[model samples]
Target: MSLRSRTAGAVLALAVPFALAAVPADAAPVPEADPFVWTDLTPTYTATADYQYEPFAVTDGYRPIGRCAQGTGTGEGGAGYHYVNPAHVGSLDPAEPAGLLYETDSNGGRALVGVEWIVRADNAAGAPTLFGQSFQGPANLDGVGSVYTLHAWIWKDNPSGLFAPWNPTVTCP
Candidate 1:
């Protein structure tokens, strides 16, 4: 081989390690803190905000659509629905749920079931993701329109799956 080629190859070999080392060791796509982690750290915060906010109220653009326990995907006694919040279109919190799946108590109080995400961005151009997961459009989940949505069992575990729309573990009151 020519000296020129050998020298070029030698330079690349020496720079490879330096380039690789420049990157952080924990550069993996894993999230630093997810719903479970945040809720564990601040259970009261999650509960308080969820119950007080009443994200699923009729005024919140989240209409009751189904029930999970009896064939629907909503909670046992409570129900879930298709939701959209134009006001919070691009909001996202790595340490908290962008939205909450709620279950009503016997006393008519709201309880936390899981977390939800909904975006009304055009083509989801500004949608957000958490825990290294991306926001999927209606094409992936059950929905229609340019909006995107996702559900995570960050507060409660879902035996069926973590990303399942409903959490079988969260029973209604």
Candidate 2:
């Protein structure tokens, strides 16, 4: 074969694998939004050594205030809400431990809270996992079919204000 022909053949061989690896034009593309978007993952927060202002089922020198992945909606007066994953906190105080919570907008952006664990992607069946005071979920638990629920807490010190559920739209993968 001519030198130029041989070189062309070698280049084609090297490029074949990469071309096959490229996303197929016919293949369905993955969604850009995080499936967990608008879905409550978990909550986290901060607290003093005394665990004052915060409470949990366990008192092993840890706080249960962790940050949430996202908010149910613009929480409490247009302030979005974020869910906390208590399992993520483990033995650390949400207040003292930096980034202990996956904070978001809530309570007029004045109040932030977290949850103990993220329910299964489909919430199919599980006791819930707690790694101290935080928890993490797979990028797409249901492997592209998973969905999440954004359960949140609404507090009212006064018993005179009307109450409504806060819901909002979020991206999903």
Candidate 3:
């Protein structure tokens, strides 16, 4: 074979085993809902639309299904927070966070977990929608008043349901 063809064949030979072995019978990482720990929990929120979350979070307690209501986690609760704006209503920006999901550590540090999509409810309209699904809010929020939201356990699996308001599987770190 020619030099170009020979070089290509060698490259493919080295890649074949990796391609075939990359997927082991059971090599998937633990579910996001499972107890995964992250390191940094930075604060980042900026509103770019009319729809938005209340600047101040209202209350902290068990949520719709007893799962900690995100930022409302108790003294020893996990610390999940929102950091987005109404302009993000239908944003497709992968890095434009809808919200920051966190699990607080023993030292009181917050570990990043999943992300949430948040939007506001206009007096004249219904909830916002994205990713082929409607945003979750339109329900009354404690700090920012009433709004819509979506929980993408993209980083974790929620036993409470992938899109459930609160993740039943998330635990304090």
Candidate 2 regions exceeding 4 Å error are 1-79, 86-109, 112-118, 122-147, 150-152, 157-173
lDDT of 1 at 78: 25
The list of candidate 3 runs beyond 4 A from truth reads 1-79, 83-94
lDDT of 1 by residue, 1-173 (tens): 96544544554454334333433575543342233433332432332232333543435444433333322544422224333334444456533333456666567765555556666546525656654566765433233345556665543445544455545555543
Clashes of each: 5, 52, 13
Find the 10 residues in a row with the least total lDDT in model 1. Answer: 43-52
What lDDT, from 0 to 1, does candidate 3 have? 0.44
The CA lDDT of each predicted structure is 0.46, 0.28, 0.44
Sort order, TM-score high to low = 3, 1, 2
Give the lDDT ranking, best first. 1, 3, 2
- Alpha-carbon shift of residue 149 in model 1 (angstroms): 1.4
- Candidate 1 regions exceeding 4 Å error are 1-85, 95-98, 124-128, 139-145, 170-173
Which pairs clash in model 1? 67-72, 67-74, 68-72, 68-73, 68-74
- Estimate candidate 1's alpha-carbon lDDT, on a 0 to 1 scale: 0.46
Clashes of 3: 13
Relative to the true structure, candidate 2 reaches a TM of 0.22
Our model 3 lands, by Cα RMSD against the true structure, at 14.2
lDDT of 2 by residue, 16-135 (tens): 333234434665543212223112121221131122123332343333332223434444332122323334322233222222121233432323222222344555553332221223
